[model samples]
Target: MKRNVILLATAIAAIGSCNEADTSKTPPTNDSSQVKTSTADNKYVNQPLVTHIYTADPSAHVFNGRIYVYPSHDTATGTPENDNGDHFNMMDYHILSMDSVGGKVTDHGVALHIKDIPWAGRQLWAPDAAFANGTYYLYFPVKDKKDVFHIGVATSKTPEGPFKAEKEPIKGSYSIDPCVFKDDNGSYYMYFGGIWGGQLQRWNNNKYDSAAQLRKPAELAILPRVAKLSADMKSFAEPVKEIKIIDSTGKLYKEKDNDKRFFEASWMHKYNGKYYFSYSTGDTHNINYAIGDSPYGPFTYKGLLLAPVEGWTNHHSIIEKDGKWYLFYHDIQLSGKTHLRNVKVTELKYNADGSIQTVHSQK
Candidate 1:
């Protein structure tokens, strides 16, 4: 329950409404007859890719065979002071690639840039990538110089990354939106925090020099801990047992009326054996669900997988592959807030006891 940052800036100022625009309007015109093409020969079909109005909280990962996609890049389009005056000067981090899943696209640009780090020169929020042994880890969030807010780590054997930030932040008391899971017994966990106090730590070793071995803000608030590492993943071997799993209104004792409040991406997964844990709520564009047999849980509320469609605002990632699943989210159009945020994918169902299914708008 420590998940803070004033509840992640009160769930990012209640989910949306930063309002900027008036740079004089006119700049749009790029119509190859209105885009969307896809003649099927692939390589990203007919190609023209340029949808940018400030892509939001994405975070996809497939790794080696490709599928990258890390979002957050809006420096302009109408209001954080006409686009970049504050709102942390518009934020950063953009990386995209595609190969399958509606197939096409061989590559897209901006592998990693926020002026290339240096404390992320201003916001650089919500990134999450992971490949492990062959390397590629990217867990973002920055804004220092006492403006507070931490979370950092970058490496790159190539997910198209020039990466490489060993440690400048990430030692922890409060960080934001990072999610990396590996467990099947192989360990590796790193679920980030939000709302001014956010939490879900563990990473004593999935490497990055173990961020100099953190752990000491009274052992870092303790709510939902894990930490055990050291089999070449790189560090920690002690702090276990903190998994309290939700209950301040974020629901899950069977969830009903306690109705969604967690607010900041969480996303831990397991599947067929159970343990789900998806998050984001009341604000961050509303998405919620829970399940838990144990990756530390008393979890239960499994509902609302996505929402805010025409009003545009939803946060997700859901992946599954061969057997199907998919979800990946983002919306809000008109193409001006840096591009207007677009990135969509659908098809997800479940409910025999697993729960999720009631969210609409694919149009």
Candidate 2:
């Protein structure tokens, strides 16, 4: 095994200062086996949901009365080429769950590993899960031998699975961070994209082929992309839409400031007839969100929901359970490297007008 150590001092210096006005939040101490609340007396569930292995890019969902978190597994070795993390080499995924809020987490290990997929490359990025027609589906992204990232689907009868991968990736879908969304009417949608000019693709034609070709490079839109999913949740539904982030005044946000705009990890949640579109910013630290009247939206940019953690990258998902909302995100505090990140959860709050309040990291 090859191990590369990125000096903590140099790594911190290169990223410059965080975009937040306050930067005093230090990485959580790895002393305890499980991430618990700050007060030892309160036995409630804490941050850093799991401790046995590194987990990042959390795609959380509620299924069968339990909160299921599908997060990309991270390790200290097997670093892939040309990736951002100094040691980001993930090969498998783990399904974590909690019976109730502030409850213990159970690790359903090895739901899908890279070696099981014939066409998948070693680099397994972010993923999301959904249940329909008595079947559970895991949507994931892996680079192929051609080095192009493609989205693939794995199916299993249960949420915790030894999932079986499709023979090939979802055609026409090529990017990282694949998130599946199921609307109230039983319609499905998948949102995906990445930094450095990655374009979001939508599913259509009972299978993803491209509702429309992505815009030309010069005309490429920086926001995340979305499309309706077919009934089976396997392919795209034609007519893709590029999601634009608009300011309060109803003007489109043009600049790529870390404070606003979608960088990657697009996720959706509906509450009280309003759609909440949340994502990680370009700085790859804070998790920000916006609100819209519909799934595909000219969303109005809301304030930051999460500030930067100890890692150089941040990816997350949002879901409401038992009348409360929670944010699942990843941080490098456990492994102490950008690539080997661990998943964490924090309480989320909303203002009276339906805008989200900024969240701080839970120790």
Candidate 3:
């Protein structure tokens, strides 16, 4: 494992059906299109989908029978890289898609940019997309003028978007990696938060303290957060709640349990009536998942969904297409630099009993 020295870093849904055309409350977007495309180098499976640009933290979804990817657009580092992940320095987002799994992938040009976001500071990180009431919604995290990270939403009439940002960040939302999961009943829930460079630990009781540090077993590790999104999909309907990821024996993991505790990259999927919550173990360099009966979980830790790859950090999304499951994730394969990554996909198999087999993307 190419694990970076474990730094006492800061901390950091559902298979609902698509009601994508339900945009009664959302105003129509009229932004001029600047869509672009790049031919994918897909001579092999499980390879980087594109090399024209660095993409990571893939949030993959199938909309209207087409595969759509919303990922963090990584730029060449202008700042020094550190445990705080400062070099990531992302400024925009590009949407990717294809007709079929092994078919040609197209890079839909900048869907959203830092400059377009009214309250955004810089470093637009991982984003996830959802379809609701006649629109495609892009949920993302960016630092505000105060340099405090907050989640925000952008809208598009189509999946491959020239998405338009709302005037402000989602109120009361802090941290990074916003994953929206829709339940079978048509309700939308959001899961988010990250520590360290993600600035999750700096917030407490819905307030932010620039000097707040992880206080060990007292605060434990920074915990991931969840909230129910209002019908419009732009704000939280309820208060943010912390998720408890405990071991199989029902023991809640402590901060030092590095590999098993939650770090960042929150994802939720529903399978056979059970909810699967997965995440990236940042400092330890692995992707892990836990099983929960509800979207807001006290989930029981399962095992690795993916072992450490060549990259220092990885974020992923899962989709079920044609009855088969696939994992969309990123690693530092194209640039060989942690911040500059390439997104890839691989088969994800579940055991008869419902556990996922660990994937070694490097293999």
Flag clash pairs in model 2.
203-236, 203-237, 204-236, 204-237, 204-238, 208-236
Please list the C-alpha lDDT of all candidates, in the order they appear. 0.51, 0.69, 0.79
TM-score: which is higher, 1 or 3?
3
Error of 3 at 342 (Å): 0.3
C-alpha lDDT of candidate 1 relative to the true structure: 0.51
Give the higher-lDDT candidate: 1 or 3. 3
What are the candidates' C-alpha RMSDs? 19.1, 9.4, 8.0
List model 2 lDDT by residue over 91-186, tens digit each: 787788877545667777678889999997657888999999799999998878766677899999999887999989876677678888778898
Write down the worst ten-residue block by lDDT for model 2.
14-23
User: Against the true structure, candidate 3 has what lDDT?
Assistant: 0.79
Off by over 4 Å in 2: 1-46, 78-86, 197-221
lDDT of each residue in 1-363, candidate 1, tens digit only: 111111111111211222222222223323323333331221111112233334566777777655666766554424343211244243445566665455543334445665666665456666777777788777776766654556677788888576776546655424467676777877776665553223222223222231243234333222333343444433334443334455546533322222354546666777788877776652334677767787666665656666544332345677665576656665444332323444545556776766767544322
Question: Which portions of model 1 show Cα errors greater than 4 Å?
Answer: 1-54, 58-71, 74-113, 119-150, 153-167, 172-176, 179-277, 280-288, 291-297, 307-357
- Distance from true location, Cα of 263 in model 3, Å: 0.6
Model 1 is weakest, by summed lDDT over 10 consecutive residues, at: 1-10
lDDT of 3 by residue, 180-271 (tens): 99999998999998877889888887788998886485346667999999989999999899898988788778788888778899999999
What is the Å distance of residue 319 in model 3 from its true position? Answer: 0.4
The Cα RMSD in angstroms, rounded to one decimal, for candidate 2 relative to the true structure is 9.4
